[model samples]
Target: MTVLATPHPTGHPGYSETLPREPESAAVARRLVRTALAAWGLEEHIDDAMVVITELVSNAVEYGRLASIRVVVTRPAKHRVRLGVVDRSRTVPMMRTDSNGDRIRGRGLVLVDSLTERWGTDLHQWGKQVWGELKCEPPR
Candidate 1:
């Protein structure tokens, strides 16, 4: 159980969880994302967050060479949510493009790119962390 103490601008604590590297981890990640975001009253962003979480976890399980994956969902400021997926692989993710036709694979990051405000990666000693940020206005 890894704990990330992210200090939000409004002093709200974030959500964090670590799960084994398995095919089923993506579903667990999505559930966690939904639950956490709902707790934060960010229902409007749940769909996007679930999609991003699935992609990140799938990539990690397929390519990441680690026993566990860590997910962190945070709101650094108002109207913004940041989702991070950490795995034990240093290989950076590439968004592939097939000019000739639509490929079945490699579209995960494409969906993420189109949905999020911004997305990027960070390398650590053990592996890399892929993250995305979404800007959403919560319902009043």
Candidate 2:
């Protein structure tokens, strides 16, 4: 796997890793999110960010094409962090409105929707990137 830890031109830190498309990759993705948030002093957002990344990574692992997936964590603004999962699949994630407490599946996107300030997919010719943003005040 390849990992990149660098600060963007805007001066905010960003992290990304390419991992095999498997269920176990979610743990690595969560660690990446936690590490980035800690470095930025944005620990308050870690819990939600963890959930967001896990769900995104899980979906990519389950449905994405190709052999690997990319996990990204970026501080797009001083008060906001963005987490994303990129997969070689065009499938768009959808929130199941009919999901209930009894169902074991189909609630990932719902949880993501509740935790994130905003979340969406960026489509590309080769694949799509599903991302979510968490908003928090910069630590003093």
Candidate 3:
């Protein structure tokens, strides 16, 4: 795995790791999120971020093509952290629901939706990036 930690163009620290697209990679992705959040003093978001990253990585590993996927953690604003998983698959994730309006197999996304301020997918020519944002007041 290749890990990179640097300042984003917005001047906030960003961390990224490229890992093999396997189920075990979810654990590594969670650690990466934890490390980045801790460095930014955003420990409050760590648990939600872990769950978010795990689901994203799991989906990528299950459905994505190519040998690897990228996990990214970035602070786009002082109090908002964005977590993303990039994969070489163009297939967009859809939240699954049954006729009774109950969540079906895609409960992961449901949990993500409930925990995040907002979440969505960014499509690119090469692939897609699914991301979630967690927000809180900066520590005083």
- Give a tens-digit lDDT track for model 1, residues 23-121: 788887887778777766789889999999888888888888868988888887788888889998999998766552655777788888988999999
Residue 46 in model 2: lDDT: 86
Please say which candidate is ahead in lDDT: 2 or 3: 2
Q: Which ten contiguous residues of candidate 3 have the minimum total lDDT?
A: 4-13
Residue 76 accuracy (lDDT) in model 2:
81
Q: After superposing candidate 3 on the true structure, give the runs of residues whose Cα lies further than 4 Å from its correct spot.
A: 7-13, 99-104
1-140: candidate 2 lDDT, tens digit per residue: 66567654223338889999999999999988898877777788888888899999999999998999999888787677889999999989888888477979778999999999999999999999999988878667
RMSD of each: 2.7, 1.9, 2.6
Q: Model 2 Cα RMSD, Å?
A: 1.9
* Poorly placed runs, candidate 1 (over 4 Å): 1-13, 99-103
RMSD of 3: 2.6
lDDT of 3 by residue, 9-126 (tens): 2333388888999999999999999988887777787888899999889889988999999999888887788899999999999865544355354568887888899999999999
Highest TM-score against the true fold, candidate: 2
